[model samples]
Target chain A: MSLSISLAINGQPLDVALDDPRVTLLDLLRERLFLTGTKKGCDRGQCGACTVLVDGRRINSCLALAASLDRAEITTIEGLAEGETLHPVQAAFIAHDGFQCGYCTPGQIMSAVGLILEGHAGDDPERVRELMSGNICRCAAYKGITEAVLEAQKAIADKSGAEQNRRDAA
Target chain B: MNRFDYVRPASVAEAVAAGSEPGSAFLGAGTNLLDLMKVGVARPGRVIDVTRLPGLDRIEWLPDGGVRIGAMVRNSDLAYDERFSRSFPAVAEALLSGASAQLRNAATVGGNLMQHTRCAYFHDLASACNRRVPGSGCDALEGENRLHAVLGWSEHCIATHPSDFCVPLVALDAVVEVEGPHGAREIAIDRLHALPGATPEQETALAPGELIVALRLPADAAAFSRNARYLKLRERTSYAFAVVSAAAMLEVEGGTILRARVALGGVAAKPWRAPEAEAALEGAAPTAQAFAKAAGLALAEAQPSGDNAFKIELARRIVARALTLASEGTPAAMPALPASPFSTKIGANHVA
Candidate 1:
């Protein structure tokens, strides 16, 4: 049966008509919305190539049903930037060479951002590597990925700290 | 994937009513069900989305000092909850050791318990699997039986239940709360899963349209809060299923064990409890020899296939090590996997 859902994708309101209830969130994003930044690697939860934020939590979009997410706030790879400026995770990945083929880069950055927001990306590189095992980099760019996650975490922390300091001074 | 009608119910009664329809399934995280549906392993005509049901997602503390964890509680939230982690560290450790961060964030407690096996034959449509298709033969019994069961397996099926949460729940003596057409009822964790006997199709003990509501830990289980350990032996360091996992809980008083609970996973159709081992440990000193003897009794009836004979020995060692770690109040270190004859290291020259 076809259903209608209204949700926010990357901070933009979207009203999607489901042709089939089995349509996955990944397909809805890539095919329906034309947001092709999210890659479908395994189409299974095994590989986190379809990672996206639903209500600020990272989940595999390939396994999630688009119709089930009626009013959820979704953030895709395209939503990470502010006009011309890239998110810290995206910038850190470029600086640290966190990608080789760049297919899994979007998922990796989204997962790293979720990790930092979830309070998992601490100062320990080993912890970061373990937590990021969901997002597989077939190119084996794990060394750079781990470094970039830690760097992005520090950058985010510093920016928040400076903001808090400015607020206090004001 | 086949076409299916989806309904997001607002309340538990509506969810249960929707689930009563024939060829309907309750959808939780869709981490496993959606994948199986994509591969044609499961074909449901309708899916009831219970994710939005109110009051089923919160973790509450009972007046008896036990925890009542809602079925919709995400695996990551349960693992990271301060009260749950402090009260049941072994459960948190087991949850963290099973899946990746993304999966844990999506999977729920009820969905984890209702997850099917990771048996390759069961997932492959081309292969003959009795569990997937009744009257069909099980190919895993004779072909690539390394990941098959070493206990509680019959000629019809040899699939192992792939659940890390079940091992610790069995050890903690948890109770499963369910609501069905009849009424609300409670089932012991050990009685929740059935052995793969003649009818491998019947996996759980729940009746049709019985939805799992929550899991309740016993109040008396607080005695094991400090002296429990979960040890999972996997082929890789992380994000892999267990080869042999053990959850051990010991209640000691002055160097003597007052009570003991042990359960094994990845080697049986369900979480296999070691009752003889627990009985033998009571009133005995928590020593290496005592643990070894208890572990031996636990695997006395293990019947293994040709390729999975090694799991019997592996489970014995894991049970002993887990008991020792629990008695000493120390966390178990990740165990190194046994070197397979076909294993080879990737050389730098091979990388492009």
Candidate 2:
């Protein structure tokens, strides 16, 4: 039996048909939709290489079924940047050299964005390291990753703080 | 994953009707179930999606000063909830300690409770495992079992339940509300899992087609909020399962313990509640010596099923450490590394 699901992937509304019920969100993105930015590492939930934002929360897309996510808003690595500008977390990762070989970079950046949005990534590097433990980097780039998350967190905070001030001045 | 007919039920009754079908399995966030299916350990003919059930996603504060948490509540959402964390700090800590942030964000409370053991033999399709296929000889009995159960194990199976969240819930005497084809019923959190006596295949007390609706934390469970802590020992600093874990909660009056609750994880087929150890703590002072005695009593019946004799001593020490931390009181805020032994502070103040 074929199933139909509608979802907003990378802010673009898309309707898809699934002839098989076993298609995971990761496979749906990479194979069917051809949005290959979300990498699949272990295919199991052990690796967070397929991390994506579902309804503004970071989740392992490899573990989630596509049919179960009807009408859900999914943000992948391709959705992080605005036009030519990169998201602060993406910029910070490059500035801090947060990855080597770069296979885990997309998941790391997405997870960091989710962490900051959740307000769990405080100014403390230890908290960032602990919260980002879900995303593994085999290159041993944790030191850089922690630094990048802290910088990006502060950047987002400052930007939001300025926006609040603008509203106050108005 | 094998091909299956997917059904998304709009209501609880519809979900129950669909779930009661033969060879049908309920699918939550699929963090654990999908993984097992990929490994060929689970092959359901029909996949019933219950994530859309309306009332099963709320956290309600009962008028009786207790809390009713829906089974569909995500692990991270429940742990990070300000009011819930303030009241049940140990449970929050245990939730944060189990899986990674991504997995926790997707995993639901009911899914966490229904997660299977992490025994390597059970997941290896080539290995013989009674829990996977009944009447098959247990391969873990003579395999790599350095982390198997030591407290409750028969020759048939030696696997330990791998949930960190259940440890504190069992200590708090939480109640599980379930609905099935028969009707609605409640099971004490401690009795939800079964010991591997002769039927290792029967992991939980849940009957066929039964779905966990919600979990209730009784009014009295909050009484230990001032003195509750969950401590876990892991193979790594983070993102690892517990080698041994303990949850200790005490009600101290005038420097003497009025009531005590202690439970252990990663040591048995289910979350092990040490009633004898808790009884030993009553009317006694909250001292390290007293904690040591209680810890010894907690592991008195523990025996190594394989080359894991060191787990017994380790479990005992962790129990005493958890008790000491509980007596010191919960931290004003959760630590950076929640529930890890390295996050221990000598003098943590109680949450106000």
Candidate 3:
């Protein structure tokens, strides 16, 4: 038996028949929708290569069953960009030379977005490293990743007035 | 991942009913379960998610002074909640130390208590594990067993419960409140997990359809809030599993010890509470020598295996340090140790 589920992927409606319960949402995204931007690292969920934002929180997509995530809004790296402009986190990653192989870039950016949005971005490099521990970039360019997240945090904080008004209205 | 029928229930009763299905399992925090499934370690026929249940995440302070933390309360929420931080600091510390930030955001208190062991043999399909397969022999006994349990281990299984949270919770005299096909009942935290005397597969006292609703910490723990810490030793300073750890709460009145509670992790199949150490602390002066003596008494009963004998010494030092730290007030953040290399090498190193 197949389960019919609807998800907003990258701001587009994704309605599909998830017939195989064994299939992870990561697998469904990569193999079926051809959204292979989310890399598959340590498929056992040890690494955060498959991290995605379900609604607003960062979740490991490898652990989620497509059938169980009915009507959930999901955001991957593909969703972070608006037309041609990169998300601030992505732009910062580039500016900070935040990656080497770039295989784990999508997850690193996704996690940093959630971290900054949740106000976990702090002044200390150690704090940044600890909070971003979930995403493992095998390229071992963590120093750059940590710096990018912190720098993006300062830039975002500078525009806090507009965001605060938006939040207050909501 | 194995094919499984999925059910999302809005109520505890509905969740318990779904567990009546032949091979169905609860799916609150899917970190452990789904990961096991993807790696071909677990293949449940069905899964029932109790995450969305309304009252399941509530942490209600009872009129009796105790707190009832709903099973669905996220680990991050549990750790940061002001009530938890004030009333039970060790529980909060344990919660924070258990996993990485991403996982803590998703992991629940009930799921932390119900996590399975991380035996290398169990994770690797090439090796036999009794916990994974009913009749299969456990290869960990004679195989690479540095992470395996050194205490309360049967000849069959030697894996320790991989949670950093359970040890402190059990020591704090917490009770597990569960609802099942039958009415609700409470079990002591210590009794919630079963020792692997013979049947290593039976890890928990939870029945087939019993669902853990909340864990209740005794009201008296608040009195000892001044002197409590969850000290962990890990392969890495962060996002790492405990190698040998101690959770201690020492109550000193005037210049003498009024009471002490100690429990150990990373050394046993179950959370090991040291009543002997607590007895040693009674009527003792608040001194480093006194703490050292109490720690020695705590390890008196420890039966360490060949490679893990260092754990006894490590645990002793940890308990002493905990008592010493508690003598001071709430400590500053623990200094991060130099994280060791990520190794595929399997051996018990007392480096931490």
Candidate 4:
């Protein structure tokens, strides 16, 4: 049965006519919508290659049925940046050389963003590593990934803090 | 994935009505069900989406001080809820220890309880799995069965339950509430998962078309919040299933153990509760020797189903270690890697 579902993909509202309930969010984004930035390494939930934020929470898009997420605010890798400016996590990945083959970089970066937003890990490298364990880099670039997450989190935190300080002064 | 009729029910009664169909299955986040469908292990003709069901997402604190967690409550939300975690630290730890952060964020409490076993044979379509096909023989009996069940096993099925959340819930005497065509009923967490006896196919106690509405933890269950711990041992430091895990909750006072709740995971088809172990700890001093004795009682009936005899010993040690950690007291803040053996503050010397 064809189903009409509305979603905010990358902050853009889209009314998708899903032909089949079997089409996962990963497939809907990659196949139908042409948002292939979200990789599908393992369609199973085991690998976090399809990590995306639905309502500001990180989840494996491959396992989620597209038909079930009506009106959900979804943020994909393509939605991370504002115009030419790269997201801090995306920039930090480049600065820290957090990827070798770059297959898992998008997922790693997206998961890092979600982790930073969750604010559970703080500045602890160990906690960051543990939290980021979901996004696996077969390239074995964990050291740089961990380093980039710490740096990006600090930068994001500082930027927000400065904004708060400016607001206080005003 | 096989094509199916999609349903979006707005209310619990409507959901139950739609879910009562012969080939209908309730969809909660689809973290596990979708994977099963992709793997061809589960092929339901009708997929009833229950995510939109009303009033099924709140964590209600009863006047009796017990907690009634809505079945649709996301695992991560429950784990991170400050009051919920503080009241049930071990449950929070167990929830954190499961799957991945992404999975926890998407998976629901009801879905976690309803997740199938991760036995390789069960997923392999070529392999004969009695659980998947009732009359079919079990390939796990003679195949590579290193991580198969040790406590509860018939020649029919040797699979073990793959849940961390259930281990602690069973120990703390959690109850499951369900709504069905026949009306509403409750099932104790321990009795929810049936052992793979003559019928491994009947995995749960739920009748066909029954929908789990909520899970409740008794008011007194929070009494052991100060000294409850879940300890999991696996191949990897994080993001892996347990080889042998244990949840230990102790009510200790004046250097003596007043009460204890013990449960084991990755050892049986169900979260195996050891009432004898809890009995052994009562009135005994909280010591390594006492913990060891209780651990021994916990695994007394344990015997190897295959090459996994090591798991029996590992399960015993994990129970002792978990008890030792619980006796020491829960940490003020959750460890970086919840429930991992390496994450605890206690050193190797302290492990009994």
TM-score of each: 0.95, 0.98, 0.92, 0.98
In angstroms, the error of model 1 at A137 is 1.0
Query: Model 1 segments beyond 4 Å from truth?
Result: B330-352
Pairs that collide, model 1: none
What is the per-residue lDDT of model 3 for residues B113-172, given as tens digits with 9 covering 90 to 100?
888888888888888888878679889878777666767887778888888889888788
Number of backbone-clashing residue pairs for each candidate, in the order shown: 0, 0, 0, 0
DockQ of each: 0.55, 0.64, 0.43, 0.65
- Total backbone clashes of candidate 1, pairs 3 or more residues apart or in separate chains: 0
Which one wins by lDDT: 3 or 4? 4
Query: What is the TM-score of candidate 3?
Result: 0.92
Least accurate 10 contiguous residues by lDDT in model 3 chain A: A118-127
Q: List the residue pairs that clash in candidate 2.
A: none
lDDT of 3 at B300: 82
Runs of candidate 3 exceeding 4 Å displacement: A162-170, B332-352
